[model samples]
Target: MKNNILFKQQLFLVLTAIFFTSCLSNVDEEVIIEEPVSEITFNVHVKPIIDNNCTQCHSTAGGTSPNLETYAGVSANAARIKAEVESKRMPIGGTLTDEEIQAISIWVDAGSLNN
Candidate 1:
């Protein structure tokens, strides 16, 4: 009877260890989640506006301030860019429509993607 009890105890311990180990392994496993980032096309929406309004003064050759030729350049100056757009300080000689200003603001807020 003592031998049977000892065998049962040993089996219980082994099963408990296996159950605990499996639980621990599952706890350590990693779960991945994929999120899609919205893409903003630069040429279609952003470029024409800049070329028509800003390039005259913001270009490298013009030397009005800084050149806004690329995405990095624009992103680096996002705060100033947004402020200028919001306040209608850009396209210096003329005013931008509310929709145009809002579009520029949205683009900057959306991570200023080059796409």
Candidate 2:
């Protein structure tokens, strides 16, 4: 009788442990995942800066020749834009702080999402 009780107790303990572990594993799997940072919309965030600063000289009718008004335009010229931004050559004659430059660079590096 005692042996039977011990065996049952052990079995119950093992089952309880398994139940708790399975619950924990499910909880872990339920954790919400975040979207990739690169997927963020550049049109909404980064374009405003370009519009305010570079567009005057770089737009369709501006001195810079090409217009960065649309995604195709911007993506096509991403390399040049990246070079100028990386070299701090853009926003010519105007000053943008390091933080602003970093933001622009990050947006570009993030695949320039159109949103």
Which lDDT tens digits does candidate 1 get at residues 7-97?
9999999999999999988876555332223533456666667767787788787787768766666668767877998877777897777
- Residue-by-residue lDDT tens digits, candidate 2, 1-115: 9999999999999999999998988764445343446644577656777788788888777857667877777777776787787798786888676655666666677776676
Runs off by more than 4 Å, candidate 1? 1-40
Question: What are the models' TM-scores?
Answer: 0.60, 0.59
- Would you list the clashing residue pairs of candidate 2? none
Query: How far does residue 17 in candidate 1 sit from its true spot (Å)?
Result: 71
Write down the lDDT of every candidate, Cα atoms only.
Answer: 0.72, 0.73
Give the count of colliding residue pairs in each prediction: 0, 0
lDDT of 1 at 47: 68
RMSD of 1: 12.4
Off by over 4 Å in 2: 1-40
Q: What does the lDDT come to for candidate 2? A: 0.73
